[model samples]
Target: MPTEILMPALSPTMEEGTLAKWLVKEGDEVNSGDLLAEIETDKATMEFEAVDEGTIGKILVAEGSEAVKVNTPIALLLEEGESADVMDNDAEGTQTTSDPDPQPKEQDGSGDGKASPVTESDTPAPAAPRDDKGERIFASPLARRIAAEKGLDLAQITGSGPHGRIVKADVVDAKAADAPAPAAAPEPSADKAPAAAPAGPSADAVAAMYQGRDYEEMKLDGMRKTIAARLTEAKQTVPHFYLRRDIRLDALMKFRSQLNKQLEERGVKLSVNDFIIKACALALQSVPDANAVWAGDRILKLKPSDVAVAVAIEGGLFTPVLRDADMKSLSALSTEMKDLAGRARDRKLSPEEYQGGTFAISNLGMFGIENFDAVINPPHGAILAVGAGVKKPVVGTDGELTMATVMSVTLSVDHRVIDGALGAQLLEQIVQNLENPMVMLA
Candidate 1:
């Protein structure tokens, strides 16, 4: 039988993506782990790999196709001794090529009446699990892993994913029933439905408001759309509070100058932002209680100091994380950050490279922005908004006025994860590290 190769979800939040290019054509023989296509997701452009060895029977979706939904059949794979005729018969009279709709009839979201076309094989292709009645169970790989770990039966649980496939949310919700239920709210009456949050205005409505004005309407890309949705959700749902502090950077500037001179021959010049990253990473270790993220029902406190640094790209931004940043030296941190930022601008980073961090740093100091509050990225406990350094007059220890380099910073915190006191302590630790730059090496 011919197997359908579906469009993959490159990232967790990706529902659809642009099929930028295809490496294999019809009748091309592809082995497992071979590069198949380049998929442009909301975050980056990633290469898709073939999971099974087969001959490409047909290419359903064309290159440069945008807004193609995940799991929609993009190509057809023929097994050994199989020909193109098998695809038409196996797909139940569906067109083998040039058909915009390539999804099989069984996966039309009408419930699991028949088995999925993707069957189990020795290779690492997407395999369909079977129920007790021998009916095929459509589920994601992550969902299946979670179900196995929890000792749950797939047949007993209902799927709410695309095309009725089981996803991680469905598995987690199914496991919740085994535990004690929380307090329930009163159900709404039949006539009185719950009110939805206002989504500002429709495109038509907004255009009407600007009828007389001359403006070019730009379409939102995947990156822009994701940024708008996630930030909107973060502002509305997360209970955010701001904490501000001013740190004297005289000692840090002196230390940085000395280190740069010594490291000049090695081609390593550390920036103020590099010092800030090290300071924050060390601060998380010093105030471990503040290093956490808000799970739905609980909080997850992480042990390592994984820090995400925001890098602005052409359309949007990417926050590539530096794992175990506290263990790295300033020179190493500078090099890694430069590489991450460069790749981020080129949209070549993988999903794992830009995700999973307890905290983030958004530094607009280079642009000469004095100070501004930053929005907290979801699942992160906080984000530090750093401002430019300026010369300011301050009182010396002997009560004499002296000039020193000062930088302003604001910590946007999720109250659910870190309290006011804990956030303050974390900020204090950061300020201390910056003021006493030599202590960071110790």
Candidate 2:
């Protein structure tokens, strides 16, 4: 039988991706572990590998195709003893169907004591339906029944099930689209008509206004689109609260300078941001309850302080996480952060390198911005926005005045998981860690 090469889901949240390029063409012989194509997800461009050895019989999707759905066949493969002619629509009719339900695990008397393989007789009656165009549209019987009930066009909906087979969820979404809107009110006189509600201008209206403007219009790419969507969702759904504090960086500066001087031989120079990362990690340890994330229905308290640092890239920024940050040395954290940031700017970071962190740190100090509130990244309990350090006069504990370098930071807390008191405690620990820099090393 001819096998189909389906599009793969590169990331957990990826629904569709661009088929960036194909490494093999029709009639090319391929083996397992061979590079099949390059798929560009919203986060990164990943290389897809062949899982089965076969000859590329047909390429259904062309290169540069956007929104190619996961599990939709991108190509057809001719297995051993199969010819290219097997890809004909007539051959599809002879394809065998398997049972959708799981078979009872009957243990065989073999020494391995494994369950027997399901047989063809186990297949239930009524195979998948075909479209009027004489093409096989893989859909479950329930989905077809629901589409019939709602009079929905099954061909228009994209399937998210295994092998791109239409499922119940897809049918529900399609049915929702087919729902009719409420009838409009009867037209009234000019004086009686209600005034239009205030809202943002439409895309067409804005474009008309900027038609003669002296500016270049740039289109949003995949990364920018994802960032906009995620941020918008975060702001709309997550209840946020902000806490601000000013920390004296004199001790951290002196400690970093002395360490850098001794480590000059090893070429390991630490940055202030590196110290911030470590301090946040230790603070999470001191206040473990605050080291949590807001899952949809529950809060997840973390054990290790996995810290995500925001690194700005060309089109969008990447938050590469430093895993088990509390256990690593300051020098190790600095080195890892530098490598991750470098890869992020080059668009070469993997999804695992930039995803899943309990907390985040966004430092705009390099840009000379002073204390701004940052939006809480979803799933993270809070994010610390660090501002530039500047020399400011402060009243000393001995009733005297002195000049010290102070950095202002704002912690944006997700009220769903972190309360005001807990957030304040976490920020207080971070301040203490920064003030007494030697305790962090211990």
Candidate 3:
């Protein structure tokens, strides 16, 4: 029997995507997860992978085809030893725009499920412990092969990684602490860090990265087209006003450091993003209007704090949701965030991973960004922007000057459902949570 690879819905709002480029040609043997093509969604150009093993029987939609619709068969997979009947079948059922409904491929909330390596349902039972890199190892990363040859117990040595994952740094650090170690690090180089923001790459520079290949471009696919239309509509129609604030982060930074020290053994390291998410969720409960979507003439208030975090992909972006952000623990949120982000980058996210957001957060702190305003992703009235925290001077209670970590945040509000006062009130509550460093727990 032949297999038909159908077009996947990249986002809930996505009706179609452009068949950006095909990686395999007819007669190319492919296994599950072999890169098949690149799809240009409004948010990004994602690589599509083969879901089942087969040989490419025929190519239906040539590269740069923009006239494709959802459920359209773009390629045919021929079984081994089977004559090319697959293409004939696909051509027989040539998808039509006239059909309003086609059975949609199973989609989860975060991304398209077509090219996934594995799903939660297929996840094998946990196997015996593997090394930090998930490979079998006789000795710890620190103990070295000498220790492995001597059958030394790495568990006896204290670890530096969460849950003792045993990174090489921990072993060397342990060695250095045990005995005054040789200086290995090079002296800091002058101009190591640039003072000014770097300029965005020009067309020439980006084109050079492709090794001088003249690449063909195509029209935006259904997802990108819809995204362009919707976001454009939002920016144009939605009355957007932003409130910016700088927050003292000394307490929050200390809280994270202290919490990581306690939880490292349990494999949990709290990130600042987790606290930000928690604070947003907690603040939403008190400021219910922020947790709402402007549905035509009325506001749809959400009962759950489903906070979506925008993740950047190759061409566009995807916002994988952190469902019930307020109900989850910091560790849980951290784990989920890692899983969601990893799967998102891999282009294996499900539809549910991208839906159900009462509020949204877009943080650029990891990139050392100081501050930025975010575009409001709709149905959600508010989106928060979080910036990096850096140590700075501050006045103490006793009239003494001290150093404190400070962060900047900006809240973009849809003015139709919110007033300046209401937006300010929500921002103030979020600030309180960050300042306290413990309100997140509540």
How accurate locally, in lDDT, is each candidate?
A: 0.80, 0.76, 0.67
- lDDT tens digits, residue span 1-442, model 3: 3444666555545545678888999999987557989876544567776655678887767788774555555676766786466335433543423121342232111122222122333221111123334333222222332233333334344544333433333344343223222222232224221111233596567778988677875645444545565677667678899999989988888889999999999998888888888888888887887678888889888888888998876556779999888889989999999889887876667666787686789999889999998888877888999899978898988999998888999999998878899999999999998899786776
Model 2, C-alpha of 179: deviation from truth (Å): 41
Error of 2 at 419 (Å): 0.6
lDDT of 2 by residue, 237-275 (tens): 899999999999999999999999998899899999999
Stretches off by above 4 angstroms in model 3 are 1-12, 18-67, 71-228
Model 1 misplaced stretches (Cα beyond 4 Å): 89-127, 130-198
Candidate order by decreasing TM-score: 1, 2, 3
- lDDT per residue as tens, model 1, 1-442: 5666777867655666888999999999987567999999888898987655679998888999887766667887776798867555545644433223444322212211122343233122223456545556766554555666675666667877544766656777675335322222123224321122338888899899999999999988888888887888898889999999999999999999999999999999999999999999999999999999999999999999999999999999999999999999999999999999999999999989998999999999899997999999989999999999999999988999999888999999999999999999999999999999998999
Better of 1 and 2 by TM-score: 1
**Which scores higher on TM-score, 1 or 3?**
1
Clashing pairs in 1: none
Worst 10 residues of 1 by lDDT: 106-115
By lDDT, the best candidate is 1
What's the CA error at residue 4 for candidate 3, in Å?
9.8
